[model samples]
Target chain A: METIVLGIGETLVRDDRHWASWANWLGVPAHTLSALVGAAVAQGRDATDALRVLRPGMDVDEAYLARAAAGRGEHLDESDLYPDVRPALAELRAAGIRVVVAGNGTVRAGERLRALDLPADLVVTSDEWGVRKPDPAFFARVVEVSGAKPGATLYVGDHPADDLFPAAAAGLRTAHLRRGPYGHWWAEHPDVVGTADFRVNALPELVGVVGGSPARPGAEPHSARPAFEDGTGAVGGARPARVSYLRGL
Target chain B: METIVLGIGETLVRDDRHWASWANWLGVPAHTLSALVGAAVAQGRDATDALRVLRPGMDVDEAYLARAAAGRGEHLDESDLYPDVRPALAELRAAGIRVVVAGNGTVRAGERLRALDLPADLVVTSDEWGVRKPDPAFFARVVEVSGAKPGATLYVGDHPADDLFPAAAAGLRTAHLRRGPYGHWWAEHPDVVGTADFRVNALPELVGVVGGSPARPGAEPHSARPAFEDGTGAVGGARPARVSYLRGL
Candidate 1:
């Protein structure tokens, strides 16, 4: 059974409005703050600098940021779940797959997931881990806690650099959830899309990619997997000579 | 034969880097110009205002803007064609589909399409039409020139408001080419996706929706078409009584 670790922001929840809400609460122009965050994401850079650039003169402390985010999280309605999320998670869990919610967000994000009655086996956040994603340590913790083989496990996320690339680098099969800020930013970027093992427009589309019966027709199967790899094609079976030569070496 | 009118900008060509290049030539920050264009796109607003916002104080004349855009267009290399483009167009044309290229770009965009040797029967641009997309007249003209019925003709584009929505409103089947600026931006917005008659990631995917042996296995046949519609499914066959009643009325 493959363990599936899912990233929450923009993957499970539509929390883009929260960015603007947080900016409004902090007295920053909503568009300016959103654009800054977008710019950072587009450049594959951390948003810490972009957030700091929002209030150049003011000394915005960590506590203030946390409280503001929590306040915005509180405003998230049940409708925030992408139309396909709940059903997809339910379907994955029903298939006996362990689904986990791990996101680079505050603890409130975890609380919100629980509040929404999402069917995940576990929920983890950067706030609890004391480290954000794209940091190898965070992915290491996720792999450790999930107890799934790094190569066989799957990490589904919306961000190319933060979620897909790092997860792929950590030896996890990566699914790029092409819906949200990073999804929109990276769709045109072939280099980023190349790093993804699977690319899906909706959550339910993952059911097929994860070795179950695909709910959508014509869903591309593990496209990034090489033709010689198992389950991809018969190219691997024809390489007996190469295998024997390698064994002799 | 189904007439396919395709939008050119990010659909057939990658023109994003040109925005930054033009900005660089104009002595403005690249990020600022790109962000302005992105912001305008996200809001479904015309980029004219965003371009004007780039040079607030300067007396930037129309000739300078045209020259700068032309210079940037000149930098576009053969590599700008998405890997799947040429083959997909060839396949569609071979299948007897009348493929047309129409985009919201300067006249140089049309020349670039010709230079790439895209197998488009007719190429049109907003500059030549004296109108831009999302305007009903532009689509009306495309239908007139192509000699295809509004209901059967397919207009493929990336922008939601500028391409898909207006084409849908104009009674043409709309395929939201899920690449480029709008593909990512609107992927999360369900309301926009609803307007598209077909949503596909690659240009080759369009071959399946346009009526051919689908290149991809399990490809949905015109997934956006309503269940009762003919050519999509047999559900319309089950509605004989309703059809008879409507005919009597």
Candidate 2:
């Protein structure tokens, strides 16, 4: 029973829309200096490097800010990582399941992952690997790092383009997270594989995939024993706090 | 040179988001049974017959009240259609271009058009025909009624699954209108031709596809002019619209 679980995407400091929300919160244009500069700095690209290629007049901070203001990047934090859910990585690992997080930028992914401090056996950065997911090459990298065959791996993600279609094309089983910003059409699809797809309303349900029977703060895992007596379990399923730690997206 | 236009869709009598802006002027929700009933009905399903099939037991009036309280499904009268950018459909027709508006229910489509009464040559109802756009058969019905070939006919609509994809598959040249309640994913597609295919931002832009120039309010027909306003015209100097309107799906 060699099992592997992986997640892949651009792990920017914050996405464009969130930057707009934060800008609204700070009463400053969130699309400005903070987003682009942070992305560029995290990705090891300097303000000069970005300027040399695209819009030369704009520097690093300015590019980040403008794009952010325009609502154009992908940003996921822990709370949003999977709201009302728990990352299933730990439970799978405890059951001897290997888990990996593949992303577009190493520095940026490292920054965000470190910020969330999610416990994972491996993290693959596209910047280092030179390819992003959806390209079979990216999936190949995951197979190499996690040492799991594509047939046995499950790629969990939100974007239809970057996640489901691509992973399915690469011979990997997919679990599309329909609970987030998947828009109305994708949400309206009936083939959503309700039970077969491991359809979860939140992240904490990830425990259900790896045969964990634990009780969380509120709901009971579908078929497992209550992992906690009270509200000490992760929002997905109950388990001792020591066996579980929360990670932001 | 004989041009015939057939329109499809539901002429629904439902409230839109803009209706709330005019609630005070329309005498609020306190009086006017027609306005009240009109406000109560939020979609084509709420129309006299369709609503009966969609939500059998749901009372239109009571549903209206509930939604009004929830700050949704507000009523929109004739005056609320705005952004001042809805293309002038009449001028497009007067310039020798045929227009067709197709949908699942013509009641809503008809209402939107009749509200504007922008003057297309023909109005085709889906209910009367028992066929809706996006089905090759529906466009065939449009051709049978209008005597136009599918290739020569141009279908302009908002729903991709319902309008663009089928029309493309049917051989009807498609023009996707980036308006209405349909989601923007279909509209903002980078490769618009791949998915429902052939895209545009507004309705009147279709004129440029045929031999005519972009029709503005009171613009002269293409026959009277030497060429388009500028160098921008259909490819190879062929009337894309005419060729479009003459081909079969």
Candidate 3:
């Protein structure tokens, strides 16, 4: 049997305006953070500054801040997520996957995930692990926890530096969610295995990368290969066992 | 001197794909078009076979011809555009501010404008049309066309029909590019001003929506009334003409 794949990220509850969660203030459509981020990126700014410019008028959650402080390093907080992501998470977990939350402020992210009432095999916080992604040791934690080899695991995420690069460096196959309106530096990254817009909007899509899934109701499984691969190489092939924790969604 | 806006579209430049143009083909970032189209709207078919899903060995482009031909009736030919676009032709001859081709198909989109090359003010094409924004008309074509009726002229494009409907139908303002991506059916009628997006991409963006030299770059003599009521319920004030046609990267 193949080892299961997992996902990690905050499950903020809200609408597109949820970017304002940190400030506790909502902006109109014309001034939403996504729009600002898009404008700033179009003007050629880096991600950190782009995030700064895109700051919401809201305040950061106390729990989110505490988790970041405990990590003792430069990292974004849990408030980064848009709301309404829990359903996506629950669906993945019910499919019997191992989910390891790895951000510094991930406790807040985890709380939100649990609030959504999803099941997971594991939830790893960088505060407890003392290591974060882009650091192979962080992934090593995944190997240690899940009993899966580095090459056998596939990491799927939206961040390029923190998620994709390190995942690739560690020899694990990687797929990028490419969520939100803006594309990241990893958009051009060669190792990006696949991309999903809104349809295959969750981590299970990568299951197809490791091994194609059986068709679901009203939905056909997609191949894990890159959409543009012109016979250069094939991606992951191990069919990980489904984690039943995510099936309800 | 009111600024001029030129809207352009591709009547035809075959690309053997179910989609209409290269920018759209490129903009989609290589994914399953069928999956992107979503199942709720896909009826109960076991599979959707757009250009994105040809088998690994098949010539993907060739595989889409049958499907594309089936939808060809929904498209308008290049000759059909010249009539409604006449006002823009006159503006170009008068050496107005800029010519904006909002949809994709940039390569062929400019052919119509450049063929005349009648001392154009500027050019904006979807390839370089800045954000390919669904609104602001990529600079409001009808306002540019009528010259004296900025408030009365209706603007139209294919996508985002809802966002544009209120302004046009209420006699406030209007524009319609076409009908598919942004403005699916279930949207209200001629509330749309005119239809474009002839091939798929925002043609105006391809031809020249953002750059080239202004008709008179530095000295923009504002000799016109406000284009609209600013929709802010504010009284009269001189609304500065947007410097959309100036050269940009």
Task: Give candidate 1 regions above 4 Å deviation.
Answer: A1-249, B57-75, B212-249
**lDDT tens readout by residue for model 3, B1-249:** 233333342112221133323214333322122222221122212122222222224454354454356553223344334233545434434444333333443443455545644344444454454433334554443344444454423233433322343223323232333323222221222222121111112323222321232112132212211122224322222322212111111
| lDDT of each residue in A1-249, candidate 1, tens digit only | 378899977787765456656566655434445555554444444554445544444444563567666764345557777778888889988877889888887676667767777888888788888999879999998889777787668788877667876787787877777566556445434444445666676788777777642212233364232222234332212222211211111
Docking class of 1: incorrect
In order, the B-chain TM-scores come to 0.78, 0.52, 0.34
- Candidate 1's DockQ: 0.03
lDDT for residue B144 in candidate 1, whole number 0-100: 90
- Candidate 2 has a TM-score of 0.40
Compared with the true structure, what per-residue lDDT tens digits does model 2 show for residues B1-249? 223232332121222333323333232211111222221221111223223222336575576556657676443344443232235456566667665544554344455555655456555457557775556788677666544666556666655556665665666655565443231222443223343223444444445544442222344334222123333433212223322211111
For model 1, residues B19-138, the per-residue Cα lDDT tens digits are 656566655434345555554454444554455554444444463467656754345557776677789899989888999988886676667667777788988788789898868899
What TM-score would chain A of each candidate receive against the reference chain A? 0.78, 0.54, 0.56
Tens digits of per-residue lDDT, candidate 2, A114-207, equal 5676656666567678886557787666667756666667666644445555665666655555332231113223323211233443345555
> For candidate 3 chain A, which ten residues in a row score worst on lDDT?
A240-249
- Candidate number 1, chain A TM-score: 0.78
Model 3 interface CAPRI class: incorrect
By summed lDDT, the worst window of 10 consecutive residues in model 1 chain A runs over A240-249
